[model samples]
Target: LHPAQDIPNARGTALIAKVKKPYTEDPASPVRERQSVGIYADWLPAPASFGDYDQFEGIARIPGQISWRFTMHQVQEDAPSWFGGSPWTGKFDEISSELTVNTLVEVRPFNSKTKKAGQAVLQGTLQRCRG
Candidate 1:
């Protein structure tokens, strides 16, 4: 996107802060190709600078493909300010929705244990990764 061009939906490409979780397993059946598991936060934008994250690694890009990617903190609480600005702090422990529509998202830090959806926020940010 051109710098001068207006940001789509008043923002950049949406961001998803996904920390790959352990593969789902089933003891009753034989082991098979495990499905990907994750704990994530959606719509958090990339910081304007790399210095924003708690840790830093080099950013790279494939010549043609979408090579840009950033590793997130294994513990979300330790993440940088860019995770979801300040509003989203302490709200993410588990996310259980596909989030196809732009609307409030329920964040349940204890959902894994309680099996419930907690309070909803405007998903912190609907647009993401502008930087």
Candidate 2:
């Protein structure tokens, strides 16, 4: 069975992860809180150079697998004025515990010089943090 097969409403939830191998790899944690699926200003900073974010994209079940995807211009010049994605982009597989984070940041205004942009794929995973 898959890792999150037993998790209730597992899709689209914010998870707390840890750095398994510095910035290059942020291994998945375990299933933890599901209600905190929004922005947390004082949350724990990610130990990776990929940099953390103001919010997390909730996981979603795709055609054959589960995935969480987010982008400002998944199309082209489509994003609004004051709304968009985070600085870090990552993937989490609850079953395999394989979370890969790829950061391609472009903060609003469609294309801005202040935005640090690049699709640098860093490897990692996701799970609940153990206290």
Candidate 3:
């Protein structure tokens, strides 16, 4: 989801999204089951130049931890090689600053005997490191 506003001390805003669904059941264990769910993050950086936009996105499974990182760059668009070419053709840009996210999620499985669905808890922190 979108943030209320751009984060202070951060180049731009960061967004997060999550989805949950039923996972395949284990045939070996009738009582044990898994849940299908994931959390995703998108970090957008402030514009470095006119029409210059950069962003990073990543996903991690529930009940686990993962890290996401990305670097920003500023590139110059090149002239079209042929007629009706896209404007994205350009020289590679120099790497700029980088962003990193360390996340942890804990998921409690559903209790089939009790007929209760599971729950998930998430914890994480974001850091802007040197490029």
Candidate 4:
């Protein structure tokens, strides 16, 4: 069953951290880093059934049409220093450049091994490739 079926009132994006290239001792090439992405929403209604989780799944057979997308870098654990300051350690322009929103995502629910009730998590593997 779809995650939405279990959580009708759910709303939120998935914060993903994509490691482009593994940092190794090889210094020939510049270290390739995965740029962070961010997805924004005015408000994310709490999940109906899933505790502390929101839906992030979309219909199958679509590309780049995620139900919700979020870049972990976009989410700041600490508040910005100033009103216009960057959430991350970069210039305002750099921070703004890292934001990205994907409309394709899907989530599913199943019995939680740890929790007493069922759990909701992402359905598919989300990955990013760096060239």
Q: All candidates' lDDT scores? A: 0.28, 0.27, 0.26, 0.31
Q: Which digits, one per residue and each the tens of the lDDT, describe model 3 over residues 1-131?
A: 22323322222222333222233465454332322223232232222211222322222222243332222222233653333211111111111222224433221122323434222212243333122
Best lDDT among the predictions, by candidate number: 4
Backbone clash tally (model 4): 16
How high is the lDDT of residue 34 in model 4? 60
Tens-digit lDDT track for model 4 on 26-121? 766455556433332212223324553333222211254323222212234465434231211111111112323322334332223332322333
* Candidate 3 steric clashes: 0
lDDT of 4: 0.31
User: How do all models score by TM-score?
Assistant: 0.21, 0.19, 0.18, 0.25
Q: Give the clash count for each candidate.
A: 1, 12, 0, 16
Kindly list the per-residue Cα lDDT of model 2 for residues 1-131, writing each as its tens digit.
02122222112223444332323244553443221112111111221223433222323223244444333212123443243322323333332333333312111111123333322122122333332
TM accuracy, model 2: 0.19
Q: What is the lDDT for 130 in model 1?
A: 33
List the lowest-lDDT window of 10 residues for candidate 1: 1-10
Worst 10 residues of 2 by lDDT: 35-44
List where candidate 1 sits over 4 angstroms from the true fold.
1-15, 23-88, 105-131
If both were scored by lDDT, which would come out higher, candidate 1 or candidate 3? Answer: 1
Ranked candidates, highest TM-score first: 4, 1, 2, 3
lDDT for position 13 in model 4: 39
